[model samples]
Target: MHSVIETPMYLRAAKAAGMNDAEMKAVVDHLSMAPDDGALMEGTGGARKLRAAGRGKGKSGGYRIVTYYCGKDVPVFLLDIYSKGDKTNLTKAERSTLREILAEVANAWRESARRKAQELRRNDHD
Candidate 1:
């Protein structure tokens, strides 16, 4: 299973959407098993739009989860969630903003990995 990282924004959105712990866990579990389960959202830098069942609602009346999964190595990032009733889709400007944010996330992750590798190499020489 792939690791999942729920961003603060997602957490807040989930809570605001009235999602309980079990519902949230269900989403995470499904994504962990199938990281690429959703439809690829264009112009969002590899973000996917996943449909998640709400407490008593079926997929049709559930929630939409936005996730970022670069590959098997990088942990799946839960970027945002919203009730389907709340919003149908993101605006063009919103998509552009999300693309920029995702770029930064990917770059930050790469930099962190680079720093860890450098530290490991230094320790190996000691």
Candidate 2:
């Protein structure tokens, strides 16, 4: 299973959307099994949106989870969440913000992996 990282924004949003621990766990579990299940959201710089069913609420009236998955090496990041009643789509400004955030997240993950690899190589030589 791919690891799942919940960003602060997502946590806050989930709480505001009234997602219980069980519901949250289910969402994480689903994403861990299928990290690429969500549809790619254009203009969000690789962000994908997954519809999560809430308690008694089918997907039609469920929550939207914004996520970013770099690859197998990197964990899937839950960027944001919102109830369907909150809003239908992201605003232009929100998309622009998400684009920048996604880029930075990808870059930082790559850099972290590179540093870890370098450290491992150095340790091997010792």
User: In lDDT terms, which candidate is top?
Assistant: 2
Writing each residue's lDDT as its tens digit, candidate 1 over 98-123 gives 99988888778878988999999999
Per-residue lDDT of candidate 2, residues 5-81 (tens digit): 99998999999999999999999999999998888888999899999898899998999999999789889999899
What's the lDDT for residue 9 in model 1? Answer: 96
Off by over 4 Å in 2: 120-126
Q: Which segments of model 1 are wrong by more than 4 Å?
A: none
C-alpha lDDT values of all predictions: 0.91, 0.92
Q: Can you give the lDDT of residue 80 in candidate 1?
A: 94
Indicate the TM-score of model 1: 0.92
